[model samples]
Target: MSMREVDPPRPSPARVYDYLLGGRHNSKVDRDAAERVMRLWPVRELALANRRFLIAAVRRLTREFGVRQFIDIGSGLPTEQNVHQVAAPDSRVLYVDNDALVVAEGGNLLDGRQAGYIEGDLRDPHRIITHPETSRLIDPTVPTALMIIGMMHYITDADDPAGIIRDLMVHLAPGSFLVVSTATDTLPDEMRQAIDMYYRNPAAPLVWRSRETVERFFDGLEPVSPGLTAVEKWTDSEAAAGPWLVIAGMARKP
Candidate 1:
């Protein structure tokens, strides 16, 4: 489907994330859902922390690891300082998401740029990895960075999130980087209850994992410094001191 198609009135995970990040791309349904979530936990702060983690990881990949290609799976609505914006201007980025609104909005944001958007689901990594746009922009034999930020928790065990990551990584060259941040089940009662509110939406139910389960997503890679820390603690920025409910880490394929 093309961008001209009007999306249905369901609350999209991307739009809900946009609302949490104070972006204007969300609809009334998203805003209402976000407000409901905020009443239970520090959703805005957590979202901002995750965003900061993504920026830090991308900067590290471009500056330290010399990675010029990026595939952001489950990349949501474009916000301030997107992946391509954070990396070098010459870097190539392909934003992938199943949400129609995300694909439409991301395509608009990436207009005339080296970056592009693919409307694909993470459960089917082969489709995303082998898509023509992905092939056109990203060379599979070259080192690339993959960002799975803020999306994995929605993928339950039935979907085999670890297998999904492994399948995607198999197509990437050695030395490729994987940056991931996922929600954990180790939250307080109130926070858990708040997260449960999201289940009310027809969208995928949140599948909070334990720290051990989340770490399994990085199975074949070596963790970067300060391995699998909270999103706020992933870097030494001021945002590192903020409260975060998600664990984030960066690893390199061997």
Candidate 2:
């Protein structure tokens, strides 16, 4: 049998994203997948823009809202200025992802005192919220930031993405925050077709949602200033306006 058949390394969503962000911790399979998507879409820009938004949101929560702990679900490979790095020195961060490689690599980079990593799927909020590492790093009694950035597009409607957000939010105390970023259903037909074809894998299909549908993910929460907007526009007013393929929002539990 061919080596490909003997042991094929499937492209990991997190690793592909890492590659798109120009990180060095991606495999050939991941780089190949990211380059393929890059040809079809501006995924590199989307990834960088999304990371900038994430840093801004975390800084907002830490500096403005006085939030000291964070639970970042669907967190990808460890990169510069990660949530823990952006937050205060005393703040704690719990990173969760479905990819074992991501979890393992992230765990290795963490100091273990202020940050921790767990292998958990986004669809199973209870397991993630209740995991020992989550319990150890996060205090549910105090406000915490829950970030689900750049990964919601993979959670199709059938997965009830809104319901998952609600389930996770129920565990945090009042004044906690929810930060989300996802792909918008505003891609041109040619671009959309290209993306659709690239992400046709049964396990990691992309599912773009309308702006209204994406906003509904923040239902029952108090939206931060600027509300839901394009990823680049989230924190920078000077950033060019949309037709952006990705949008982001930050909200607080009342």
Candidate 3:
């Protein structure tokens, strides 16, 4: 009998993140990837903190700033307390992700009325900005929240993540918001071993950046309260000062 060829399982960042969040959508490869990263860092806690920051930012935008539209680019697999759920009932959201599984799952999870999911690459900001779902849900003339949570580190310097932000923001009206969270390069040598692990695994390798490099991604925008801070500290005034593994911030395009 001839043996059939079997392709290897590829670990997706979205699925790895879902695994870290204790979601059931991830495959075995993603679970292994998350577990390997957990050996060097508190991957699960970091994921929770990032999700909290996103929730807080979205709430602030909807309640305090009166933002009715959201474009969450690189938005991962949906879990509890999604943007449209946390936002005002009348608000509309468009969740964009490059991962096919993420897009498909998100489409199934969200109501097409208030929220929609589409396939989009972070490097191609224009396509997302002008996507049909974005056009249907987001008003370019009004303030919108543009969120890129826990995904920017996947975009290497050659991809020009800063430029992507600028291009996306250029299409939004003044007072629009930008919320971002990314891995920091402040990890100790021992902890940095996880970076190599990702590179070797069937998962997406990250390009961790210094605080300075990340700050540049918000150039020409006004920082929200607390400014750029650790993800755990972004929403909590009493959260301990960091040597944190992940950092996040919210800014407004003035």
Candidate 4:
């Protein structure tokens, strides 16, 4: 499809997240919705914390693991300091998301030779990781970091998110890492329900996982330092309302 078809000058996950993170690349609808969600927690730190967690995860993978490739599943709209920017510059990142607007908006931020965008849904990581275009950009033989940042809550348990992570991990090399973060219900029940109810207005059906349930996605991997902690607590002060109650972690294969 043409760029217009993909972007459509519309609202999307990427746009909504951009608004959440205080970026300028979003539509009015996105901004309004994002504001409503943040109101559920009554603080802007929620978005900043999520972005910080993502940056830390990417740097660790790039510097410590010497990883040069990434497959960011549910990769939303690209903002400043995106995965490619934080990764080794030589890194080739294949971003997959169902949002055509995300592919459109984020696609323009990259030189397709190094950073590639594919229009694919989260439930279809198989097709995304194994797609012909991704094969051309990513060398599966080398270890890759599969990122599932801040997007899993949109999926239901019936979809078997744990199985999805396992299947994706099975396709990677031994040294590969999976970096993930998702919303959890760590706040007062009313606040958690408030945020969930707000997000219900969006295109995806969000299912906030508990800390225990979130751990299930890391089934066979080695948990990195500060394992399975709240996204903000992993490296920040999430003292207020658990700062939106999101869980995040990095795990290595083998």
User: lDDT tens string, model 1, 1-254?
Assistant: 33235454777777788888878777788889899899878888888878988999998999999999999988887667779889898899999998776787778877546899989999999999889999899998999999999888779799999999999999999999999998887767788777677644445677878888988999979999878878888766444532336889899999
Q: How accurate is candidate 3 locally (lDDT)?
A: 0.82
By TM-score, the better pick of 2 and 4 is: 2
In angstroms, give how far residue 44 of model 4 lies from its true place: 2.8
Better model by TM-score, 1 or 2?
2
Q: Against the unseen true structure, what C-alpha lDDT does each candidate score?
A: 0.84, 0.84, 0.82, 0.78
Candidate 4 residues 1-254, lDDT tens each?
A: 34344543434657777777777777676777677767666535666778888899999888888999899988877676779878888888988888766777778878658888889877876887679878888887899999999889878888889988888888888899999888776556766665655456555577777788988899889999878887777665544334447778999999
Residue 240 miss distance in model 1 (angstroms): 8.7
What C-alpha lDDT does candidate 1 achieve relative to the native structure? Answer: 0.84
Error of 4 at 232 (Å): 1.7
Top of the candidates by TM-score:
2
Those runs of model 1 whose alpha carbons end farther than 4 Å from true positions after fitting are 1-8, 199-203, 237-244
Quote model 2's TM-score: 0.91
Name the weakest run of 10 consecutive residues (lDDT summed) in model 4: 1-10
Estimate, for each residue in 41-158, the C-alpha lDDT of model 2 and write its tens digit. 7768778889999999998998899999899988886676678878889999989988776777778778758898899999999999888888888889999999999889889899
Better of 2 and 4 by lDDT: 2
List all candidate RMSDs to the true structure: 2.7, 3.5, 4.2, 2.9
Over 4 Å off, model 3: 1-8, 199-205
